[model samples]
Every structure is written in C-alpha cells, then in structure tokens.
Target: MTIPQAQREAAELLARLSGAAPVETHISAVYVGRDTAWKMKKAVALGFLDFTSLAERERFCRRELELNQPHAPGLYRDVVPLTRGPDGRLREGGDGPAVEWVLRMAPVPAGDFLDEIAAREGLPPRLLDAVADAVAAMHAAAPRAETDPPAAMAAILDGNVPSALRAGLDPGRVRAWAAAARAELARVAPALAARGAAGFVRRCHGDLHLGNFCLWEGRPTPFDALEFDEALARIDVGYDLAFLLMDLDLRLGRAAANRVLNRYVARGGDAGLLVGLPLWLSLRAMIRAHVEGTRGRDWSVLLTAAEAHLAPAATRLVAVGGLQGTGKSTLARALAPALGRCPGALVLRSDEIRKRRFGVAPEARLPAAAYAEGVSAAVHAEMFAMAATALAAGQAVVLDAVFLDPGHRAQAEAVARAAGVRFDGIWLEAPLEILRARLAARHGDASDANEAVLLRAAAVDPGAMAWHRVAADDGAAAAARSAIGMKGHSMC
Candidate 1:
C-alpha cells in the first residue's frame, strides 16, 4: 500500500501542467503523470496481476490497444518506448537509451465521465439509450475466444471476496452470498458454455463501469480496459453487459434499469443473452457492494436492499393463458408497471423470452429456421425457468404466453406448486373478428405473433383452467384490475 517513488514523481509533474487544467479533488497517482499519461502494468507476479518487466508491459499494452481501439479509437495513443534523458528525466522522445515502455493516452475530460454525470443526474433516458447502443456495438465488435470463462470468473470472485472481508465486511455474510452465487452459476454453466460455443463469449472491457466511460463529443466513449489478462476480457457477452445493467439497477431504479435493458436487448437483437441477466445482475450488485465497502466509498445508500430489490415482487405468481394476439403481452405490460407500486412486481413475458432464446429481439421478424422444434423447446424451458426463479424468490411473475398446449400449462402449474405459492390462470377470449383486427393494427409490439399465427393459435383448446375469464376487446387495464379484484385484491 506504500506509494512508490515513481508515483510520487508523477504526481509532482502533473501539478505542473502547461496550460490551465481543470481543478480536481482526490486525484489519483495514475492521473498525475505527464500530459500524456504513462500506464505501466501493475505487475502480474503476485498471482493476481504481475507486470514485472518492460517486455510484459509492452505485450499487455498491445493487447489493450487491440481490444479497445475500436471502442475508444481517439483516446488510446500508440505504445511508445520510454527512455531516460541525459539529465535522468523520463521523456517521450529524447537523446537517451530506452529504459521502459508504456501505453500513452490522451487525457479525458474530468467532468465528462459517466459516473460524475450520472451521479448528478441519475442517468437520464437519453444517456441510458447511448449506453445501451454503445454496449450493443461493443458486443458486436468483440472477438470470441475458446477459453473456460467460468474459471476466469471464479478467480475474480475469489479475489474480490477476500478484499471485501479484509475491509471489515462480515466474513460469514460474504461467504454465504458467494456460496449462493456459486451454486446458481453451476446450475447455469452448461447454458453459458453452450452460448459461448455458439459465439456469445467475446473480448470485452474487463473493467466496465461508469468511471470507465465518458462523453467525448456527445458520444459515450469507453477507455482503460484491463490490459493484463486476455482471460479477463474474454467472457460471455451477458456477463459483460450485466455489469452495466446491474450497476444501473443498483444506482438508479428498477424502471430505468428495465428500460435500459429493453433498449440494449432491442439493439443487440439477442434475447438469449438475457437469460443470465438476473443472476449476472445479482452477482454484479454484490460485487459493487463489496467494492464500495472495500474502497471506502459509501454505496450502500445507493443500492437497494439485497432481499427487497432481489427480484420483481411476485408474493404470488398467476399464469395468464390465452391465444396469441389476444392481448396476453398487453395485459402483462399493464400489470408490470402496476407491480412497481407493490415493492417489486416484474412480468416476465413469454414472447420476450422466446425472442431472446433465438438471439433476436421480440419485435424482429425471424425466419422459420430460427424457431425449429429444438429452438421451440428451448424457449419454453427458458420461460418456465424465468417464472419459477422469480416466483420462488418471493416475486409475483405474470407469465404472458399463449397456452394452446396443455403441457406448457402443466409445467407452469408445477412451478407454482413446488414454490408453495398460490397460482391462478387468467384466460382471455376474443372472437376471430376481434383477433384479426387487433393483429392488423398492432405496430411496435415486442411480440412476433402475426395474424396467421393467431388464426392458427385460435384453434387450440383453452384446456381446463382454475381461471377467471376476461374479454380481450375490453380495456386491458380494466380486465387486469378485474382479475385482481376477483382474487380479493386491488390493482390500484
């Protein structure tokens, strides 16, 4: 923890900027270097990060440039040879023998960093859209690697846990949380690895956070990626994107978090990437909590209660069954915003779940190849899992899907039973005329159902249901409220 002499000298030099520079408080030694900052590896020999020699630093610097140039094109200066002058001063270019090498960078504006701006404004919708777009672009541009992402992720958790404990957090509580997270990761590893094999894991900004992003000419720009380890940067895109999503949810509110996630998923056109979001967001929130606690920053005030904000409030989940284009998703959407009034209520739509499984947005028109028998099965499994997980964790999950098949209905009922929670099905019915009209006029919908799909779905049996019936032509809010009223509850 001792400040090295080199860092001390760098601090002194930074105070002597040529022109008037922005004044700041709590300036890091890393920031106080020459006008063009010199970034050396923090050394890798320590089993964590060892950059012992100039050669290693040069190698990692190239990796940094290779990984970040596309995203931070203007800021990452070229890797330059660092040499000492005749007067023993480290200079970029001077008549002296080379002593070391480092990656130089164009300094970012102090006030433009997203953390400073968002902390002040709490992440406006425009900024959220920009962040979502930036992340989607990064996911598209990042390269995939054939490596074990789980092992790499475990190492990060291991390092962070000890640091948190050392910083005076309750060790028992930390271990308990870590154990739960590890258990969930084990359950999902096969799915994650499968996605990775299918080209979802990629080179990412290993240390993505608000501080790592800044506004440059009205665009969100990312910089200062983890330069030392390719393993750190190579990860499932969901795990990578989860950092930002979870951070937003913790720092802002659920509504904004959901909006940003919707925007990101819409732009990326990948619904499969979202399956791991709940778990990843949970892990990310825990990581941020540990980091804040360890780094002497007060983040507890910003984070929601781990238990209260854990999942959408489901206290009791009720599955709603109906044909496609019969207003299933509309009812779910109306219920979701209202669920917000009750601590936490999140409606996990089957349409959205289906689109995500095929790696496309729900609104995107996909070919039949995208929904092969196997894909169909996978999508249903995901829907069941999402609802079960949320409901089990004490959140109300309104499953929005066409229950044309009895088996799908059975599986959902089984989840409700196993969770020991009350479950009900709200069946919606609309005449063929009503269905066609609704489908024809529907635009900007997240569901992929078309008039033909609805016509085909309308023929399936509604099956016996412990259900309440509602008409689709009636106002969705009124129907939804009526359904709740039938259960002796008030939607308002």
Candidate 2:
C-alpha cells in the first residue's frame, strides 16, 4: 500500500532473477529474466485503482489476461502466483496464500515496438492503416458493457480536471473548458446512451498508446491493456480509440492522426460515436498534460495539441481519378490527410466499395462480369452517395476511382455540387507499360484490377481532359504536394 513496501518487495523479488533486472514504471515492474518476462503490479493505491492486497493484485492479474487476449494473444499468458510454503520459501503458484501476483508473458521484440519504430521510420501509410484496421477489428469483436453515460463522463471530468489544473494551466481556463466539455457531453448524452445500448462499450485496452503496441510478425499487436479499473476501460469504442488518436496526433501530426481515424471509420467504426469525439480527445489530452506535469515536464505543448485537435476543420470533396496503374489511391491517401478535419478526410475508394459489394476480400479475383457496365455504374453511384453524405455532414471526402469515362467524372462533380461543397479533381496519367508493371507487382491490395483492366481503361475514350492533369510517370509527389499544400505529414 506504501511506496517503501513496494520498493523493498520488488527489490527482493527482482534479486532472484538470473539475468537483467526488471524495468520500473509508475504501476508495475517487469523482469526480463529469460525468454519469458514477468510483470508484477506494485502494492499501491491510487485514486483510480487499488492493488494494495495480494487478492486485489491477483484479480487484476486475471483481468489483464482476460481483457488483453483478443488483440494481444500469445503475449499475456498465465498469472504466476508468488506464494510462501510451510517452510517459508517463496516460489511460483502453490497451495499457500499468494504473497504476490505476477503475470508471466511471452517477450515481444523490444526493438520493434510501434513507438520505437515510429520514432525511427515514422509509421508509413500502410502501417498506420494496418493499426486502424486492427483497432477496428478489436472494437468490432469487443462485447459491450452497460454504463451510465452522463455519470461516467462526469466522474472523468471531476477526477482529472484538478490534475490538469495543477499542470500549470490557469484555473479559470481549466474550469471554463471543463464546463464546456460537460455541457457538450450532456447535449449528446442520448447518442452516447444509445451507443452503449447498442453494445459499443466493452472491456477495451485502457492504456492504448504507441508504447503498448508492438510490431510482432509484421503486424501491430497491442499489449498491456488496462486491468485495474473496469469503469475506466469499459467505455464507448470511440472513447477507447480517442486515446490513440490523440496520442498519434501528439507524437506525429494531425494528418497522421486523421489517417488513422478515417481508416478506422472505413472499417466499421460507428459513425454515431463521432459526435463525442472532441470531448474524448480533450479528456485524453488533459490526462497526458497532468501526467507530464507530475513528472515535472513542460505539459503546455499538450495543451496546444489538445486545443488544435478539438477545433473542427472545414469540409470539402476531393476526387482522384485515373487508370488502374496511375497511382490514384496513393495520391488520394496523401491528399486525404491534407484536406478537411483531423486525421484528414474520409477515403471512399471504389475498389474497396466494389469488393464490399461483391462480398469478397480485397484480394479476391472477381470475374469479368463483376466489372461489367452495370457493376461499374453501381460502384460509382454508391461511392458518390457515401461521399455526398459525408460532405453534407461537414466531413471531408476523397473519392478514389478510375473516372476514365466523362459521364462518371461529371457525376462525381455533380455529387459535390449537390452537397454544396467545393470540389477539386486530379487526373493522373502514366504510360501503359508503367501501369502494367505496377498492377503486376500489386498483391494483397484493395484493388483487384489487373493488366487487362489497365489496358481496357487505357483504351477508353475519356472525352475532354478538363480536370487538373498531372504526369504520374515519375510519381505524383510534386503534384500531390502542390494540390493539397500539405507539409507532408509532420511527426513529433
């Protein structure tokens, strides 16, 4: 329950390890003795959680095992009980009462942690998309928990705001922002309650930051989920995700954060949850601000970041059109983070839409009939409808498709006009051979188009090249940068 007690016990326990000593954090000490590692919770009580007793420690240990099993399988396994026998010797798991509880887990590659990787290489578009996909899947599979929406939010505000005030921010400003946040949550309480009723709330990874996610087997797997408090972890999916979004925006830039959000929403994130995103993101920033303050770090930077993310961006429509090998999707993704709100724009790619329409994976090979005129028309119509809705609701959108036909291109522009938003179109052009090579090299991608599709698209008579034509033979970097005026994804 006290600091000295925890320190002494951890020291004695870590002394038994044969290899390197364990690493210490605020709550836990992790010993990497051999191939396996042991995580032992400190016997301390905080305002949020209490692991003062052996039984309390054991219960939370089990919770870490249960809640983390979905996204972090093979990492969290077997809660080891450090017990005392009749002879007074300490060992793991026995009939005697557990003096302490340690969660034994498989060691992940220390060098490949997402945070470390991002710090070095900066999370590329593909990896960021993969993280979004993983988070979306985790949210989809996590079961909901019934929670009182207003009261739950109020608790966070009351508990964390004081800490934020102590972080060198003016009391008046903190109070004013806190009041505004509470009022906003009240206005959207019904939507939040509905989301909870719909099973959006669940046992989520409470502490889902870059540090917790590691690149294992070339895929990002999130580990060390929150286990101490169910009330904090069992929340609406958007709130659970807002932490990562805020974290990314702080560590990277808003564009990087926006990319993650857009991708997550594309992969079945609840559209309804967006209404409360600002508050969730603000709360997350406040927590970070206070935590940094406690460590005697200048947390004002986080305050600036919090304000920027909370402020919404203007919405518009951007469409990238080209043949199969013109790198239309790549340009759209680059430009998507540049336009509209945080985490950029909603990327509604026709290839992804077509795959969904066909009820097949992105890599599935569809028959020729799948790309028939009727099928092609349906894809364009659906993409426009979705884009129109997002634009109307004040969200920026990027439509990626082969608008080789004049009619399809006109229709896309018409959709933007109907939504009363400014529309910008970029048409990419490259040699047929280049297109063919790009298509041949593609694998496991959302686009199912092959060399045949490329040739067919090249043969089409796209009347009157009116849109901003860019030579994509040498890649669309210069053109993309010129069009969007993006600083090119600034990372922290």
Candidate 3:
C-alpha cells in the first residue's frame, strides 16, 4: 500500500522533532516519537503486501506490538491512535478524531546495533554470549508451528530467485546454484521433516541478521520480525539459528559461529538441527542478497558486497585431524569460528557426516556393513568431495578427521592443492595420563575410540605429522590462539 499523503507529512514532522528519526530506504517512511519509533509501509504492492485499509493498518499496528513485546520487553511500545481533525489535519492523540494507528516501538541507543559495534570493534565475547542466550530463550518461549521446513523454504526460495535474476545477475549461474542448494536441502529433508513433526518449529524472528539485533542493558534483543506471515517467522530452531551462522560466516568468524552452535546445542542438548544448518544458511544468504538488490537503489551496494562475500564464503572447507580423546572435536569446534572469521569458511565434521550417512547416531557404533573396506572408502571419498566442492568455490573449509592413516593425509593435501586454499593440519595430543582419564570417565560418548584405540594409536608412530602437534594442557587455548594468529588480550 502506498503511504497516505497525510502519513508521509506526519512522518516528516515526527522526524524533525525526534533525534533518532530517519527516512529508511526500504520502507516508505520511518520516524521517531518521544519514547518510541514508527514505520509506515508504502502502499506499493510487492511480493508481500501490507495493511491497505486504515482499520487494517490499525490492527497490524496492535499485532506488531503484541508479538514483539513478549520477547523484547521494554523495546516495543503500544500502537497508539493518531488522530486527524475534521479540517484534515493529523496529530498524535488529538481530541478531534482517530485518523490511523502508528506501530510504536521503544527507542534504543544507536551504539546497541551489533553491526555497528562489529564494524567498529570486533564483537566482544560478552556480546556473543548475550546474543546466544537471547536466541536460546526466544526459542524456548516460542510455541511450535505445524508447517515443515522444505515447503516453507520452497516458497521463500521461489520468491527470492526472481529478484536475484532480475538484478542483472547471471541467470544460468544463479539457476545452477539454486539447483545445488535444493539438492543439499533434499539430502537433509528427513531430518528437517522430523523437526517439524517433533514440534521444534516455532514462531521465530525470520530475518535474524545482525542489523535486526541490538543490545539493551547488555542483552541481545531481536526486533522487527516478518510480521506478514506466521510461516515465515514460525520455523525450526535450526533455521532461526542458521541466520546468525550465515551472518557470522559473512562477517565475523566461522569458529565463532561454531562456538555459538556448540553453546546452543550444549544448552538445549539437541544436535538434530546440525545437518540442516549449512544448506539453510546458504539459502538465507542468497535470499538476503536478492532482497537488498531488488528493494531499493541504495541497497545496491549491500547486494554487491554480500554477493562478493557470500560467493566465496559459501565454499570454505576445513580438514580436522587428531587422535581420539585428544580434544580433536573440542579444538575443531573452537577452530570453526576462527576460520569462519574470514568470509567463505565452512567447517564439515566427519563425525556428523559419518553419522548421517550410516543411519547411526553420533554415539552409535557402526555395523560391519557400514565400515567395510568399500564403505569406509566411499565415506572418505564423499567427505573429500564435499570438502573439495566447498573449497573450490573459494570457501575456507575445516575437515575434522582422525587422519590415522598417511593415505588420508595425502588425499586431504591433494584437495587443498587442487582448490588453491592453504591447508593446515592440526594435531591435538594430550599426555598419556590425560588420555587415560578422559577415556575412562566417558559415559555414552560419541567418539568410537576408547582407551584401546588411544593406547594403540599412541604407540603407532604419528611420524610425519609430528611437526603440527599442539600440546593439550592448561595452555591449550594459548596453543590454539598461536595456531590462529590471534593477538592475546592486553593489560590496560
């Protein structure tokens, strides 16, 4: 709907009086009031429609406040009636009459914007923790939705493809990428379908990019959700989390994204969503690039920048290797976000992929059929293929594997060379006593190797890979910091 002339005039007046008000490019007009802000959607009919009638707008105004307030208390304000006198003059709470309704929102400080904070100074650990906690709480509080992920994705993907093609992009390449994305999604459809059935689906903040998040009183808050459709906002927790992962891949660290994932999983104790994250993240990035490009002229730069960042980031593959119980998984989890700090970095864990392929849980033992010579070869072959595919596309990749055999090491090196990305072999080894204690205390662990595997592998010469060893101790984090070239905290 086009913004009514009166609304536009009112917005201009509001902007003049308030310090925070500004005319946003995507929306028709936005302005700040004394304690809150307002956005008046243009009357233009795009792929998504807004309230057309005055009464409809009033209803939407109330719903926006109702929906956002529960999660973002002290952030959203009541939608107050805007009165226009009989003489056709509009004013806030005028005695004359009710002309329309404005969706009011509590004003937040400008410095609270995460993107602004990240651009100026890399995100602080405290903020990262806050954001993770906020989203976890949001997911926990949300009610489950009935729709499945694939069908929801299809509609969104269809809606986004046209805009991407229309942005004077290569249609053939876009089409090919879309096909690849769809195939990846299909591969994980069963897991996604189960999430939908198990009531993991909920009303989420559909667009969870950095810009929509802010810190108020030292806590991360999500605002301005997709109010138009319940299906868009209502989704699997993994889908909601994928937005942040994609955003992190686009800007901060892949290791950080991994850390975020691990923290969320540790809190919720659900890794079921792991398989769906990468595919969903890719789609989310693609859709965002398209939306920014098509929405307005000012957004062209955002589109170009996102295309450049995401095109390569979509491919980074990480190769991880360490003996069982030496903290290979822990270090890999830690390293993921660091590698992802650079755009186009993706970490593919062998454990997760292996479990997915063999129809076993991460902790389940593999059957003989699943680990026969041919089957083992096939698993590695597929993993290498995935790693290479992501890397060839200019993404930084981390592959987590035991690298027990010299042959596996060679294959991984060949992939790095073929893809022209630097390869780092990380060997995490602990003291014999530490390994013994770690293995002995394990209860229902995912790692197949126990004391026997550790004892055997410890004796077998880890000969050639000796140069890459990182000692596991209290200083383990320091070793990791050195491996990644991150400067240590300075004493002010």
Candidate 4:
C-alpha cells in the first residue's frame, strides 16, 4: 500500500524529532525514537473504523490516552497535535491549527514483548500466571456497558464474515464457518443477552494478545488496545479474553492457553463463563481469521482449529506433586492443554486455593499457622473438592500440590476413580540443595514457600509412593517432558 500524502508529511515532520524511521500498521503509523514512540492514526476509513477527519482522529487519540492509562499506567503519554507554526513548515506540538494528531508514548523494551520472549524461550513461562492476574484485575476494574451485548456481538460477527470474504479467503470455507458460528451464537443468544444484563459486558481491551504486551521493569503491561470502535470494543468480557486464549492455544499450545483461562477463573473471574467459552472462542477465532485473511494471508487454518476447540473432549485427571521449587506447578501448567479438551485442563494449585480460602490476594504472604498440619489438610481438601467438581462436570483436572501425605495422594486418586476418569500421578524431585536455591529465587509469586519451608519439606518422608518419579533438576522444558513425555500437542 502506498503512503498517503498526509501521512508522508506527518512522517517527514516526525523524523524531525529524531532521524529514526516510522513503522506503519493498517490503522496507524508508529515512529519509535530513542526514549519515546509516536503513533499517528491513518486518516483513512476502514469499514468498521473511521478516521476520515482531523477532529475525529484527535478525539480518538485523547480517548486512547484516557482509556489505556488505568490498565497500562505510565505507558501512554499525552496526545500531541501535529500542527504548523507561523512558518509554512509542519511541526509537532506547534502553536497553530492542528493538521493531525499522534499519541505519544514511552518506548517499551522491544525484546520484552511476550511474543518475542516466547519465540526465544521455546516454552510458555510461569510468568503467564502474572499476565492472567493482570488481565483479571483490569477486567474487574473496567466499566460495564449499557447496550445489549447480543446485538453488539451479532453485528460484529456479521461484519467479520464479509471482511474475510473480501480479503480473498476461500469463500466456501468462510461461509461454512460463519454459518456454524452464527448458529451457535443463535443457540446461546439468550445466555449472551443475560450475561450482558448481569454486567458481563464491559469496555475491554478488544485486541489482547502476547504480541500487544511488553514488560516494564519486570511487570507485564498490556498496551495497544482497540480504540477505533466503541461497539466493537465494548462487549462481553469473555469475548475480550477469548482473543488472548485463542492466540495462546494457536501459537504456544493448549496447555499454555488453558493456564491463562483456568488462572483467570481461579483468580475470581466467574467460573460460569466457561459455559459460554465455545461461542466466545468461535467469535474471537473468526475475527482473527478475518483480519489475517483480509490482509491476503491464509486464515482458514485458524478457523478450522478454533472450530474444533468448540467440540468437547474426553476428560482426564492428572495430579502433579512435589515440594516447592520441584517445578510441580510449572510442569502441571505446561502439561494441562494437551490433556483433555480445547483450552486444556483446569489446574487447581494449592497455594492459590489457600490464598482464596483466606480471602487474600495471591501474592499476599500468609502467617505460619496457615501452613500448620490441620490448615494444610483443609487447603488440600478444598483444592481436591474444586478439582473433583470440575472433573465431574467433564472438565479435565490437574491437582498441583506437594501431596506429602499418603492419604492426600490417595484422595486425589479416589476423586478421579469416583468420577470414572483415567488418572496419572506425577512425582517431581531434585536434590535438597537445588530445591533450596530455587525456592530462594522466588519473587512476587502466589507460593509463599521460602528456604525454611523447603528444608522442612525435605525432611519429610513420603512413603510407599506409587506415582511416576521424575527428576526435575533441569529447567522447565525438561521437567515438563519428564512428567508428560510426548503427550502434549498444540491444537492445530
């Protein structure tokens, strides 16, 4: 696509700040300088998004600043107007009638973007739990919409299909997928309408993905939210979250995707949302396929895979056990997606459960009594109860805890047996010194285990263990393979 004259002029003026060049997406042109980034909207009209006039662009820029600040603090700066000075030369932030507008932002570390990090690391890291936590908090704080969500969503889906066809996708495939999706939507329309009325529809980050997130001082900050259309951006919160979940399932693996969904649900998001997940997943997948397809890229594969995720899979129960830092939670998370269904299995972590039981934040440290023998039993009982309930409902389950007692391990097995599902017990272990070192490095985690806890756990003897024993001295990937072997596959 050729650059329009107005954008060309804007670029020439943007270069005046620094000699750096500008990067362009379909909707906006972004120029990244040494310490800052300037994003100028393309004064063009896409069918769904319009920025045909200077005033409209400026309004959106200001809205972008206002909308993104609460979720990504310190990331979005002022909306600077591109204007002409007394001289004929166009200048940014000049004192004259504004010619255009750009949202100024603090430059983020390029390498810290989650997609780039995932590419290099070759596995989904545990930090994803933090990402899920961040999103849950953001959703909780977002304002609910007053419109009818079913109508809003139906309109968006209607637009997405035609967009895909216009983008040169195989018309037959697009038609089939769209029809199925619409039928499903129609079937669930009542639930969608009710969820919206119940405050589930909200102004949300409409385009959430690993690619849109970056690390700021070791914390994941989501940016570049959809700002073009209010109708598109404000809808069911599950639909907003489905984008991230679908991306993770497609790119990373099902386990990775499941971790985010299960993590979000465990972190106080409505577990009932899972009932509508298939439709939400279909909608997000269709939108993604349409976006890429319209760009003359093949998107049929995504449509196919996401459609399959809509189908139910046989449920199984997997239990992962070890002392803290033995990589139990990490392995369990990595193994989840490949286990049963679409987004994978629900991992019930004991630490997060204990925190919930105490009505405290996951990162909040609890007192020593919280770990007393009686208290620990109660926590395990609650975790198993939740896991069993989900399993009984045909959702796959993975219970993550030390399972230090024979009775505790037996109870996990019993839950699966009573549910008539296959069960696998995994035991992760490493040298005491290694466990101590790993525990000491923990920072800002739900697990409050420290070196003292590690030493105490090491002293206990877990007798008559019948589970598969796996050495976890290696890193996360190796530990994961040791636990689940070749059982994991991304839902392609």
Using Cα atoms with residue i matched to residue i, what is each candidate's TM-score against the true structure? 0.64, 0.88, 0.65, 0.81
After TM-score superposition, the amount by which residue 399's alpha carbon in candidate 1 deviates from its true location, in angstroms, is 9.5
Tens-digit per-residue lDDT, 1-492, candidate 4: 544676788878887675676677878877788888888888788777888888999999999988888878778979988788777878878778888888999887668888888788833455887788888888999998898866776787788777777777778877877777777778768877888889988999988988988887678778888887788788778888888988887888776788788878778636546546777777788778777876767887777875775666777788889888998877877777666766877888889888877878778899988888888888888787787667754577888899888898999999999999888888887888888888888787789988887888778999998988888855654545445543435421
lDDT of 2 by residue, 162-186 (tens): 8887667757767777777777678
Rank by TM-score, descending? 2, 4, 3, 1
Task: State how far residue 441 of model 2 sits from its true place (Å).
Answer: 3.7
lDDT of 3 by residue, 1-492 (tens): 234564667665566656655646544456665676776554444556665567767766676677778878888867766677666766666676566667667667677788888787868655775677678778888888889678887776677678788865557766776777667667767767888998888988787878888887667888777676776788888888888877765577554565566546434545566556656676676776676556544444434433433332323334557677777666665555545323223455565566657655455676546656676677688768767655543445666778887888888888988877666676777778888898788765456667877888778765577326788666765686576453442100
lDDT of 3 at 350: 65
- Candidate 1 Cα misplacement greater than 4 A, ranges: 1-3, 7-47, 86-88, 100-102, 149-160, 297-492
All candidates' lDDT scores? 0.65, 0.77, 0.66, 0.79
Q: Is candidate 1 or candidate 3 better by TM-score?
A: 3
The superposed Cα distance between candidate 4 and the true structure at residue 125, in angstroms, equals: 1.3
Q: Which of the two candidates, 1 or 2, achieves a greater TM-score against the reference? A: 2
Find the number of clashing residue pairs for candidate 2. Answer: 1
Across 1-492, the per-residue lDDT of candidate 1 in tens digits comes to: 432354444333333432333233221124324456545443336564656665776677787777777788777777776566777766664556545555667766677889888788777766776787788888888777787756666676667678767666666766876676676567666766777788988877877777888887689987767766677778888778777766665557555666565566556545566445555666666667766776788745423333223343336666777877688866664555344222234566666666666666556677767657687778778777766665544445677777767888888889889888777677888888888888888876666678888777777666676577888765755776666653313332
| Regions of candidate 4 where Cα sits further than 4 Å from its true position | 6-8, 120-126, 186-198, 320-331, 357-364, 371-394, 402-492
At residue 275, candidate 2 shows an lDDT of: 63
Q: Which one is best on lDDT? A: 4
- Quote model 2's TM-score: 0.88
